[model samples]
Target chain A: MQTKIQELRKERKITQSELADAVNVTRQTIISLENGRYNASLILAHKIAQFFGVTIEDIFIFNEEEENL
Target chain B: MRGLFCGTTARNNEEYRKVVKRRMLTMTILIIVGIATAVTAYMAFHHSTSAISDHTLGIYSGVGFGMAASGLFFLIRDFLLLRNEAKLKQQRLEQTDERLAQIRDLALKPALFTMLFILFTSCLIGSIFYPVLIYILLITVWAFLIVYIIATRYYSRKM
Candidate 1:
């Protein structure tokens, strides 16, 4: 999965910790999410979507293989 | 604050070490306090052959018992807290184990851990207690399980 979290964060001029606070997760979680080290839960996806004032679909893009699998 | 990223390096061992160390420290402190209490009690009990005045014996006995009891309580609290923390850590690890697959019991891990820890610890400690504390422990454990079952089920369904 690819997330435009960094792009959105940069556009909003928000720091990782700031985004994490908004999403109610630790800064490490935000960093991991950005680095693609792990995936976020659906609830967390919704949270990020709400924080960014966008839908989850807009932020996350699935690879073809991921989509097929 | 130790490097936030564990880099897939197993953190379970590290966590287990910390908990074991804490329990060891708690047990050591309790033992020291127990020894001091025993020494004081012995001194007071045998200071003289003269039937040890009820007043003096009573005072020393109360002091010794109080110290020992408080020490025991601290040990028990530390054990309980460590047990709770370990359970949470394990559940969180399990929840975050794999993103490739969804697990049905993911949401239930934390509640299961809390209830099981409380129940097991209570039962274990109760086996050696005044037996009255057993009732209180059982009540607390049952109430916790009920509240937990309700809250988790509600969230899992609602979400």
Candidate 2:
């Protein structure tokens, strides 16, 4: 799973720490999400989406093929 | 400060404060118990009237001192968390972070298996020297399995 969190954050002029604080997570979690090293849980994804004022699909790009593998 | 990002709400702060208070209380109890145990052990050893051996009393003292030290360490940590809101919020975030939770869960199984393996190997080696050690280690292993089974059953029903 890939996320547009970095791009969205940059567009909104928000730092990773700010986004993480808004989402009630550590800054490391946001960093990991942007680096594609970690996949956010549904609750976290919802929180992030709400923080960004966008739908989950708008930020998270889920690849069916990659998921199948 | 009203809308500032503290990673916790009023309800969370209240709950965290309660948790810290509970932990502090437990630590205080542990410290009291530890000191009492250590003092009793010392008195028993010095009096030489108790049926318990000197070696056993020494072990009890050591365990008591260890418990007291650990209790003090955690008590201080909880005290700091209680005193500082920013540190409390950061600690809460670290504790509740999904990624860290996942990593901890992932690491738990391997760590438990490794510990069991080490204990089993030590038991095997110790069996050659002392028969009682084998029973102790075997009992410890059985206790672990029993606890694990109980926890699995509990979560299975709850979840």
Candidate 3:
């Protein structure tokens, strides 16, 4: 999953720690989600999307692979 | 991993895996402890009860030594593994409050169970193998249940 969290946060001049606090998650979680190391739950993803004034689909793109499994 | 049941925040299986691993370790330790306790009862203190000081002391020593060894084993294992597990958990802590609370409860129940088991054994294992142990076991069960209920009520209220 690719998230627009870093782009949105940077546009708003928000630090990862600040974003994490606002979203009620650890900064490490935010870092991981932004770096594509982890996926966020629906609630967290929704909150991030809302904060960025974007649709969930806009903020996060989930991709299905060919024979990757 | 991505397709795992996603129940809001409960969908995250990493914490579940970690908790299950801890539980498995605890259960394995408990089984070993139980077997050692049984063996210690049958052999160390029973047949030739005179070689040891007192029959009661012999039984107590068996359980005590078993518990001591078990505690030492887990402490050593936990000391080595807890730091790494905790660190990974830190890196992945998007945990919901409910799941976090459940994890805390899971960690505590094992210790509580161990404490109660030891207490019961030390106080009343003499009646073991005989019908007299039935009463002691019943009383211990009731006592533990009542305590657990009271404790749960208090903590629930606090929460």
Candidate 4:
């Protein structure tokens, strides 16, 4: 899964720490997500989406076709 | 005046540096003391002369062992403190991290399986050579397995 978190966060001029605080996650979690090293849980995904005022689908790009491959 | 001379960041940095320095000093002193005591114990144990009275030899051995024991305690205490401090620091830095939770989940099955495999295999192997020891080990392993299973189930349900 990929996400527009870094792009959106940058556009919003928000620091990773501020985003993490908004989503109730650690800064390391945000770093891992941006680096594509970790996938967020459903609750965390929801929280992140909510914090950005966007739908989860808008933020997270689910690659079902690639997964099938 | 204090705030004018030193901001919050500077004060915090200074306090942190002081704490780290104190910890390093204490650990260094403990290591030196532990080494000295252990060396004294080794010398006393090996260098006793025939001219020394038996009672005096006993007292010397006792004192040496006591010092060595205290030294061992200090070393072990410092080790545990260092490990615990690292863990606490990580926890504080990653207070809401779900990755830590995931890491625990990832580790659980393999650790449990490995422990079970080692205990069961060792018990079976010992049964071939030492029947009495095997029986005791088997009982101990079963007790441990039961406790582990119950605890796992309880935590699974709770979590």
Candidate 5:
């Protein structure tokens, strides 16, 4: 899964730390999500989406091939 | 609203503080018990009339000292967490982080298997020289397996 978290955060002039604080997660988690190294749980995804004032699909791009792998 | 989010975070922080305070109390109790045990072990070791063996006294002393040290370590950590607001917030975030929790869960199985392998090898080596040591190691291995089995069953039902 890839996420537009970095782009969205940048567009909103939000730092990773700020986003992490808003979502109640470590900065490392935001970094990992932006880097596509980690997939956020549903709860975290919801939090992030709410923080960004967007839908989950607007930020996270889920690929069927990735799921198959 | 931002106010609602802040309220929730404040509530969570309060909950974490309560949890830490409870742990500190438990640690205090542990320290007292440890000190009492150590004193008893010391008196038993020094008194000729005591019925307990020296080896048992030594074990008690070690356990008591270990418990005290562990308790002190955690107590100090909790104290620091309570004193430092930034550190407390960071620790709380890290503790509640889903990604870190997942990583911990993923690491646990491999760590357990590695520990079990080390214990099994020790048991095999000790069997050649110290039968009692081998039995103790075997018992530890069995206990670990039993715990794993029981935990699996519990989580399977709960989850």
Candidate 6:
């Protein structure tokens, strides 16, 4: 899973720690999400989306072939 | 390496450096103490004055050597880990993560089930051989369960 978390956070001038605090996750999780090494759980995805004022789909790019068909 | 310390600000990096320093100091102290105890025990065992003293020295040596061996293992582990500050930072990040707690609980389910199975089997076998052992096992299990419940409740509330 690829995420626009780094881009969105940078645009908002937010640090990784601040974003992690907002989403109740560790900075490592945010880093992992940005690096596409780890995918967020549904609840965490929802929280991150809400923090960035976006939909989950907007922040997380899921390849149709890889994720669905 | 990339997880905790990666991309940290200067302030956070300095804080982690202090933490790593403290950890290294503590581990070093433990290793030194363990070695001293082991050496003392070895000397006492070798220079016993009488039979009773020899038996006491033997027990002391066993305990001291066990502590020293475990301490050495931990010291080596800490040395390898702390040599790279980034790895320690990453470890700290993982420890603070809430997802790890949930994963730990999930992992414990299988371990708990296995422990219960073993305890049950042990109790059954003990009943056939020496019924006294069954009572001891029952008490031990009950105590362990109580402690586990208390710890779980405490951590859940605290976290």
Ranking by TM-score: 2, 5, 4, 6, 1, 3
Clashes of 1: 0
Minimal lDDT window, size 10, model 3 chain B: B1-10
Report per-candidate TM-score of chain A alone.
0.90, 0.96, 0.87, 0.91, 0.96, 0.93
DockQ of each: 0.09, 0.75, 0.14, 0.35, 0.77, 0.26
Of candidate 2 chain B, the 10-residue stretch with the lowest lDDT total is B1-10
Candidate 3 Cα outliers beyond 4 Å, as residue runs:
A64-69, B1-159
Task: List model 2 lDDT by residue over B1-159, tens digit each.
Answer: 211222232336668787678778999999999998988888877875655787888899998999899899989988988989999888777766778777777777787899888888988998899888899897998899899999999999999
lDDT of 2: 0.84
Task: Give i-RMS (Å) per prediction.
Answer: 6.9, 1.9, 6.8, 6.7, 1.7, 5.6
Residues B85-115, model 6: lDDT tens digits: 6676555555545565455556778877898
If both were scored by TM-score, which would come out higher, candidate 2 or candidate 5?
2
Query: Can you give the TM-score per candidate against the true fold?
Result: 0.36, 0.88, 0.36, 0.51, 0.85, 0.50
TM-score of chain B of each: 0.32, 0.82, 0.35, 0.38, 0.75, 0.54
- Local accuracy by lDDT, each model: 0.66, 0.84, 0.65, 0.67, 0.84, 0.73
Among the numbered candidates, top lDDT falls to 2
Model 5 over residues B45-143: C-alpha lDDT tens digits?
Answer: 787585688789889998999999999998998998998888878777877777777777777778778987888888888888988878888789778
Distance from true location, Cα of B49 in model 2, Å: 2.6
Q: State candidate 1's TM-score.
A: 0.36
Q: How do the residues B1-159 of candidate 1 rate in per-residue lDDT, one tens digit apiece?
A: 121222132346455546445655776676677667666667767774655676766776677667667777757655665667645454334334333123334545776788678777877787686667667777877897799899999999999
- What residue runs in model 5 are displaced by over 4 Å at the alpha carbon? B1-11, B48-63
| Model 5 clashing residue pairs (backbone) | none
Candidate 1 residue B70 Cα shift, in angstroms, is 13
Q: The CA-based lDDT of model 6 is what?
A: 0.73
